[model samples]
Target: MFAVPALSGADDGSWMEVRSADSRECIMAEQRDERLGRRRLHLRLRFLAGESTGSYVTRLAARNNLPVEGVLRSMGIGPMLPVEPQYTEMYLSRYARERLANLAGYTVAEMQKRLVGLRDEFLMSDGDKDDWEWPWDARAGYIVQACSLCAAQRGTRSPAWLILPDPWHVCLRHHRWTDNSRSTQHPYIDLSNLKDVVRAQQRLNRLGKHLGPAARWVFADACSILVRSGYLEDPARTEEWAALAKQLGEQRVRPLAQLSRLSLLTQDLAWLEVRRLYGELGQADYREWLERATRRHGFTFARPLKEWHSQHQPLSRGIPELFSDQSPPSNVVRRATGHELPSCLAAVEELSCLPWVRLPNTMDRLFL
Candidate 1:
């Protein structure tokens, strides 16, 4: 029997009593909730590197942050015990949970019940036992973890549980209607959690600042948001974009041309900028388009520094030499210096191979 320390600060509190040595009672309420089928328990814990009891307590705590004495007081745990403290602190996950629970001063059972309550309120309702896990299953865990990862990577407060996990999965039903990326995760419930996931996705996209797939995702998500919010009708904007994309693909025209035409038609200035920044257009073509855009729609021509850099940056800089062939690099057409390089050219030395991709008569290496 181990004794928990008495509280130094005196104040009337409701959770200070437990029966002192009953493991079952420590989380009995949660077990009951699980048995009742109202909620499912997910315990997250971090334990001291190699302690047993500490590990167990950590597990319990992770499931719900509960104070040690409060957890044992009503449970009849002894005030003092003969067990070595080191022996109790060895389970990794278990200790993690216990630490969480202790910090929050909540017993396993109480936290379980609360989670059940949350499920009842937030999860989708289905009439079957197995089907009832909507929006909060293992996939939900993946989404949450994804959110955590995005938060760590991007430093945003977006909800992770609604977005797809690594490898970027999406439901066919949801993604097929538009240009959104397809995810491999199935049986998605696009309930409230999806909003949080989008927030995280948007945050990460912003952090990426129009680089790699991050910029693409941001663009896609913005379109999706407009469609979902009824600002743009379903299949209308996407339909228009698709139609233009198809026309361009059939004609072997560039993607920017397609995007710019669609943006002009849709009255979305942002998309027009997207087309300009991501189109890999030549300086002459860009100037022509800028003039055309301003004449047709009174659009401004200022380029943000980040957007300019993304459009004009060299593709061979950070891209691994091996994978550069799989996709055409964005920096092939340098917007800033009006210099264009061969699409596959990796070095200034390669410029001599194809003089047409460079200035008409000059052989100097041009920085974009």
Candidate 2:
């Protein structure tokens, strides 16, 4: 068994209930050590006379670098502590196991929820399963953030039919997919069957509200592919709908309208302004055009992103290249892996050559 400091709040010496020291501080110090290229630390801490017993215990834990797992192990505990079932589980048990216990029945969504929740409980909590030490990965946070944005705007108004978190949203967010196998198991959503279709359609309906006139085709194409791939197998009449879908493609419907509006021509000040207006749309290229055009106008932009480039820069040296009144650049794509703009003008362009416009040095410096 691991050894832990026998610090306790209870008179009975039930020390395990005590929380560890400033977990944040300890983690920061560990980071600092790594930054300074140091490996091991020999830390010593002293308890103040005025410090509360709880604070003292926590300080001891931090000084020893003992984690929750370490403390639990020292107490001879197998950390797989079960928690009180949440409302969903209780309801599931009541309907699926108790009331309908005689019958073999379980909803797909309900089963999916239970599987994910249990897996998350294991990863997020100690063996006692009461406390959670959520691990953070820049990548996982990004995925979660994306999931949240998608979830938030889910039914509001978006062309994308469904942004279902693949297989396991929770596991992805926590970044412990290896320990949580449920994420990989339910990879593709089952949209072919009746019940699953209803669920899928419901999700699409929420997403459909956000669809711009131009984005309709992309949505249609995605649906067509799903059906053709047997993921959306429909037993009803099929050819009747196929012709209608073909006609839609011929008309350049759905995604065409939105696509047309996303012109690549950089010279169009109107387009550039539109891109920069929302601060959200038009992706990186929009920002690029905005910066170049704004700088060319002889006004240095500082409030948003600090920039020094002017019309003197190579990209801006010539007549501004107005975005062609056509489709968005074929290369301009939404993120596939992470949230970072992988290879946009913002990433590749140099800013060192650009001069920083400074105010005249004056009375402010004279005092020194």
Candidate No. with top lDDT: 1
Write down the worst ten-residue block by lDDT for model 1. 359-368
Q: Per-prediction RMSD in angstroms?
A: 21.1, 23.4
lDDT measured at residue 180 in model 2 versus the true structure, 0 to 100: 12
After the best TM-score superposition of candidate 2, give how far the Cα of residue 85 lies from its true spot, in angstroms: 19
Compute each candidate's TM-score over C-alphas: 0.21, 0.17
- Candidate 2 lDDT trough over 10 residues, lowest sum: 358-367
> lDDT of model 2 at residue 43?
44
Expressed as tens digits, the lDDT of each residue in 1-368 for candidate 2 is 22333434553332234333444211111011112212122443332211111222223334556543332222222222221111011112111111111111333343334233222222332333222222221111111111222322322111111111111121122221111111223222222332332433344433334322112222323222222233222222245334433643312111212111111111132333323322333346744764664454334222212232122122222111212334333233221111122211111111112222111111111111
Please identify model 1 stretches exceeding 4 Å from their true place.
1-161, 164-282, 292-368
Candidate 2, which segments miss by more than 4 Å at Cα?
1-11, 16-132, 137-203, 206-368
